[model samples]
Target: MTIRVLIADDQDIVRTGLTMLLNAQPGIEVVGAATDGRHAVRLARQLRPDVCLFDIRMPLMDGIEATRRLAGPDVADPLPIVVITTFDLDEYVHGALKAGARGFLLKDAGPELLSQAIRSAAEGDALIAPSVTVRLLAAFADSQKEPPTQPVEPLTAREEQVLIPVAHGRTNSEISAELHISPSTVKTHVAGLMRKLGARNRVELAMWAHETGRA
Candidate 1:
């Protein structure tokens, strides 16, 4: 099945570049483009693409608010969202995930990683590929500690086993191989762990995992 995508950004050039890069992939296509947050949200709701790529800053509504509408807790059915931004700071990255973004990526995160992120989002997997995930998220994650007020749920032994590699940034296939389980089984376990831990995506799971010394 083709992975449908919607691109939302104020810059025409950036939107065009991303659309072109993703379209070149085997099973990916851009369904539409939006120039601002409000339009992005409208197109996303109407089209229901496999993934929505949103920029952080835009007129009428910013990415954060758009993210909340599409994937926030209040939404009856949340759509998967990947936030693409030039700003790669902790606050934006963390904020985007909190607002329900599945993945947070930097704009300069080259074509390969950009395509990979879209594919991952469509697959219900989280990605913060090297060019973006490492340079931005890693530095922040390494420096930060767990929030004092947040108490995480306890994990089962199987969940702990599953989280080990995910916390270290391994892909589902990698985790499956390491755990001697099928990819589908790995995905199921991942979903279960995510719900148990109240994690938005693998990145947040990783943070909570390491904080609990379960990594």
Candidate 2:
């Protein structure tokens, strides 16, 4: 199945470039493009694309709020969103994550990273740009005043093994190779961990690991 995408960026050139690039991919399609956050929201509601790509700075509404409306925890049926931005400012990154963005990337992260991010989000996985992952997450981790609540269902030893690598932003395939497990098995463990930890996504899981000194 092709992955349907909605592009939301204020710049016409950037939007056109993204549309052309994604549409050229074998399993991806750019279904709609919006020049501002409000229009993006409208298009999202209308098109119901598989994933949304948002630029942080936009007229009428910024990507942060757009993400909140589309994918925030409060939404009953949240859409998956990936925020792409030129500025790697901690505030923007933090805002996007807080607003329930499944992926975050720098604008110049290259086509490979962008494609990977979109695919990850479509797969219900989270991906942060590697260049900024450790530094940005570590900064957020330091600001936490309290650790996550202990889960009613405690993590098993095997699950703990899975959590460590995942906390460091390892993909299922990477974790599988490291732990001598199959990718499907790694995914099962990851799903179990997310359930036990009450994490909405992998970033939250990673944050919990760091806050609890388990990472």
Candidate 3:
């Protein structure tokens, strides 16, 4: 299936570059482009694309708020969003994730990683930039004075096994192969983990893993 994408970036060159790069990939199409966050949100709601690619520093709203409006916890039907930014500032990373962005990447993450992030988001998975994943999560974890919330029930041994790789940003297929389980089973465990941990998405689950020192 072709993955339809909506891109929001203030810079003309960056938007054109990304649109071209993604359009070149198999099974991916850049369906729309917006110059700012408000327009992005409007187009996204209208287009209902498979995924949204947003830059952090757009005018008239910014990507973080745009993401929150479309994919935040309050939204009954949250759309998949991937935030790409030139800055790797901890605050930006934190804000995007907290705003319900499924994936986060540095603008320089290159074409392959960028495509992978969009695909992952469309598949209900997530990918963070490898360079910033550990540092970003660690900083967020450290900033929290309270202990990580315990799961409503104890995790199974398999669930524990699955959590580590997920926190490390492994895809479901990767985790499935590593744990000698089927992809369906990996997804099942991931779902259970989310429910038990009160996590809204994989990103939150990853953060919980870091907070609890499981990652």
Which number leads on lDDT? Answer: 3
Clashes of 2: 0
Model 1 local distance difference test score: 0.82
Model 1 lDDT per residue over 61-114, tens place: 999899999999889988889998988677887788789887778888888777
CA-lDDT, candidates in order: 0.82, 0.89, 0.91
TM-score of 3: 0.91
- TM-score of model number 2: 0.88
Supply the TM-score for candidate 1. Answer: 0.85
The sequence of per-residue lDDT tens digits that candidate 2 reaches over residues 1-215 is 99999999999999999999888888999999999999999999999999999999999999999999999989998888999999988899889989999899998988887888898788777789876788866787667676567986978999999999988988777788999998778889889988888886787778788888888
Instruction: Please name the candidate that would achieve the greatest TM-score relative to the true structure.
Output: 3
Indicate whether candidate 1 or candidate 2 has the larger lDDT.
2
Taking the tens digit of each residue's C-alpha lDDT, what string does model 3 give over 91-189? 998899899998899988999899999988887888888877878676776688987898999999999999999998898878989999998899899
TM-score for each candidate, following the candidate numbering: 0.85, 0.88, 0.91
Report lDDT (Cα) of residue 209, candidate 1.
Answer: 69
Q: Where is model 2 more than 4 Å wrong at Cα? A: 140-149, 176-185, 211-214
| RMSD of every prediction | 3.0, 2.3, 1.8
What clash pairs does model 3 have?
none
Best of the two (1, 3) by TM-score: 3
